[model samples]
Target: MVARSFFALCLAAVAAAHGDHDHDQDPIAGPLQALWYNTLPGDGGTQADSVFSGISTFGRLPYLPCLNHRGINYDIAFIGAPFDTGTSYRPGARFGPSGIRQGSRRLNLYGGYNVPLDTNPFNSWAKVIDCGDIPVTSYDNTFALHQIEEGHFSILSRAPKTDATKKGPSLLGKTLPRVITLGGDHTITLPLLRSINRAYGPVSVIHFDSHLDTWRPKVFGGSPSEVASVNHGTYFYHAAQEGLLRNDSNIHAGIRTTLSGPSDYENDGYCGFEIVEAREIDTIGTDGIIKRIRDRVGTSNPVYLSLDIDTLDPAFAPATGTPETGGWSTRELRTILRGLDGINLIAADIVEVAPAYDTNAEHTTMAAADSLYEIMSIMVKRGPLSVMDGEKEEDL
Candidate 1:
């Protein structure tokens, strides 16, 4: 199964590289893209049963685990990591996953396209399921970290391992479960890496954030020992040392500030990353950032994307605990993400959304939601959903 999936992935990647086309008129549309509510015969109601009558290809919510017309499972789970214990400045991110889940139900399930929104190496199969939040405490950072890790371990274990004697929770039941984890803080990524390595071997990380979060163990002041505090400030060093992420694959896109101890590492010569500082994005543009990211992660590895909400400027995203001055604009982020239309993204997380910090929950949560949407788009772009074509023939 693993070998088959890998082969399929390779073929998809080649297609995405060569099948590049314009979006104005789609040559390929599948059942998922079949119109459901576009100008009904006589009914112009606002609800589903009335406005959404008929057996359109799109599945109903509480989406069942069934094969679609494209022959893929409906697998995508929304898992939450409520551990702000690592947050440096804010204490409200523990509430992030729950809020984002609530917000998600309020929007269109597929961004109005039943076909996967991803355009590269067009994904032809993926099943998305919202598995709900990972259970953990708010104040206990260590406990929260453990809980988040365990939850993702379950997610990564979605694919059956021949080494294991018993059947385990396989991703979307057949493939790696496409997980979009809602974060408590940047530190939540440590546990997540543990799981990804277990499931797919050591994978590369494509990190996007404001601060580097690579402060050495025991470097943080609040902790009695490095293990004592484990604040959001210390994920990279922990993961790098632990062999969870490839430093070469780890690209830092929006760093504007420095940790008390990690200055020497960010120096272009010191760190093996294209540390594109916040202001440079405008002058350099997202295309450069995307190229740098591709080079950093390499086209072959399955990349994990982690978005620390602080990567955005506080003016645009003020809900984070740490608000940096210069950061990526929403449009800038969208451009970069859209450019990565076909990379095989295994899992993604959005961290540091402190609802308590903003006047209107401006920064963290909203950006997290938008960031999640981008991730969702990325998943569909890289899976079987990508190449699935021919929007259901207008309900015959």
Candidate 2:
């Protein structure tokens, strides 16, 4: 009887020890338990239901409805200027913003490339939000331009309040949210420049295109009764005439299109921009091209980069309205852009992506989307600009 009682006591002790050991072990061991632990109900919990539902925004990012342009709480606004009335050849770039956004879905939350300068902008300190397409007037070009300018101005006019104690990338000790515009067409750049010029007078331009786009406005051949005639090819001419460009600092790269006459070059020169022909890539090389760009723009001037999809050879990007045969390849453009780190880039746009012309591969829109990401990475690395009393000043 005593032996039986002792055996029962020993079994009880062993059971207690085993229970204690189990209690000390982690509750979440297998994949199912880990998933359950991570997906609990509350803040910081994963919601499987809303994983990928809803309207697709840029890069599938969180959509902040900015219909009235109020409650703006982001460092970078990805806005769509969806009007292609300004196109000279094709009429489908109005769909560019959507196409670019769709292509961006393929990008993960990691750095775009393996290069030293290719960090992910979204993962940086900057807060970005997609503020859907601006409501442009389909019938009236002047009204559409006005709306586009106002949309940009509304975002630029207000500077986010930053903690003065912390030192980081910002404009004038404050954090002013920069704008990365997904364009309708190249002509949209004219109004964008207008809005930017209002805040930081006469900034330099880094124009990438197959054509100079500095053609005379008379090329449009509109009646005197019509609204101020403007097209993708001639907006820069107007921009120059209005003193909105730093003529001595602006530049055009990857131009291979035939000029109307020698006066075209003369006019472009008068606007204060040097041209780097497409074939020059072979002669001077990528490094030399980057040097020329940096030397021309300098380090202090506020720069606006406008990339026309036509800058890529049609073989690679055939969806643009004006595809030149001899142009920079995708790899060359990526290297050149990566080399342009540390420039004071304030505002940027990627335009002229007519997705309708894109092949089954969707190469044009994908290139545009990737190029946009590259530009955004550059901006994030540069950080915010220095503004003083509602104006952008050169960094001291």
Candidate 3:
């Protein structure tokens, strides 16, 4: 009892000592004031949040529901399509959008600059924003595709941001805002191309993949339903049928997948795309590959670049829905993309990232994010496409 009473007395004495002096007065207050006064304005979190600190958007970009335009304008927008029902093998690419964004958290930190490009896209004239994921239905593939199309078209239809009003290479007279999609799967590209067709008519495509995605739907053993036929493997064929692609102008790179037969190559040609097989990367090299792509698509045509994560070797990007071995390294791919620097790359998508198969270090997701950073850098370097300073829209 005596010991307990002594303990109580000691606690009371400590409390009295702590409360005796006020933090708001004298020495304590002066130092606190100094610390507060010396602290920077954004130190509390506005201009410089920790890379891991907030809701993940691609590159930590501003989040906007671009589908609800409401007078909102942007030069570039990153839209997320989180539907992956079209996958033929693996199925978790539905989670790709969020996974890619998480991988991109470090992108805009450290001044958001690209030294080689000598520009910072985030700080440049482009008003870039992240339009959160399209609320696509998982139950119905056809309806989900419709939703994706509608969402994409809504963004494509928006007027460009004031500073980014440079004319595009499209048939449209006014400037068109560019959309860099974080894809659900390769199937999303069909709807994306449909939206692009509405804005720019049939544009040339620069397809990067380990598989010849231009396969005819019949090759997949004839689906019972029409919607079932239009999948990742066959969306490009549908795009061709819908007149969404420019004939003889499209090209496929990094193709190394097995085909039904030699007729598959003929079908790919019929779909209006020439192939640069994956094995050629050994003999022709990245520079040669880039030259072939540039030669096929030309420098002035508005190009829609669709990159499948599986284009990178499984050693580098194994987390994709349909990863194949003997594909390009991330470095080789990025270098080739850099080679297309001056070409009219209008819009792009990086798809087929199924994070369910990823490593704990997120190699596949990081590859996708870094590839986007390179693509975004390329876009920034080119600035917005224009129809020459004083040229009229119809003179071409």
In lDDT terms, how accurate is model 2? Answer: 0.78
Per-residue CA lDDT of candidate 1, range 93-188, in tens? Answer: 877776555434423433235233423211234445555567787666667777778767765544311112332223232344566778777888
Say which candidate scores most in lDDT: 3
Candidate order by TM-score, decreasing, is 3, 2, 1
How many clashing residue pairs are found in candidate 1? 39
Question: TM-score for each prediction?
Answer: 0.71, 0.81, 0.85
Best by TM-score: 3
Instruction: Tell me the number of clashing residue pairs for each predicted model.
Output: 39, 8, 0
Q: Where does the lowest 10-residue lDDT sum fall in candidate 3?
A: 24-33
Question: What are the lDDT figures for the candidates, one per model?
Answer: 0.62, 0.78, 0.85
Residue-level lDDT tens digits of model 2 in 1-396: 999999999999999999987784432112233455666666543222231344667766667766575766676788899989887677888899998887786554332333557466766656777888888887999899899999987876665423223332333334456788888988899999999888777889999998988887765435243455687888898899999998689999999998668888998898888999989999899998999999999877778999998999998899887778989999899888888878888788999888999999889888988887778888777665543222322331
Model 2, C-alpha of 261: deviation from truth (Å): 1.0
Query: How much lDDT does candidate 1 score?
Result: 0.62
lDDT pick, better of 1 and 2: 2
Taking the tens digit of each residue's C-alpha lDDT, what string does model 3 give over 1-396? 999999999999998887885543332111223455557665442233467676889988889877776577888889999989998999999999999999998877665778766667777767889999889999999999999999988987777774346655556677777889998899999999999998889999999998888788888737768988999999999999999999999999999998889999999999999999888988989989999999999877788999999999999999999878999898998888878876777799999999999999999999999899888877766666564223223321
Candidate 1, run of 10 with poorest lDDT = 387-396
- TM-score-wise, the better of 1 and 2 is 2
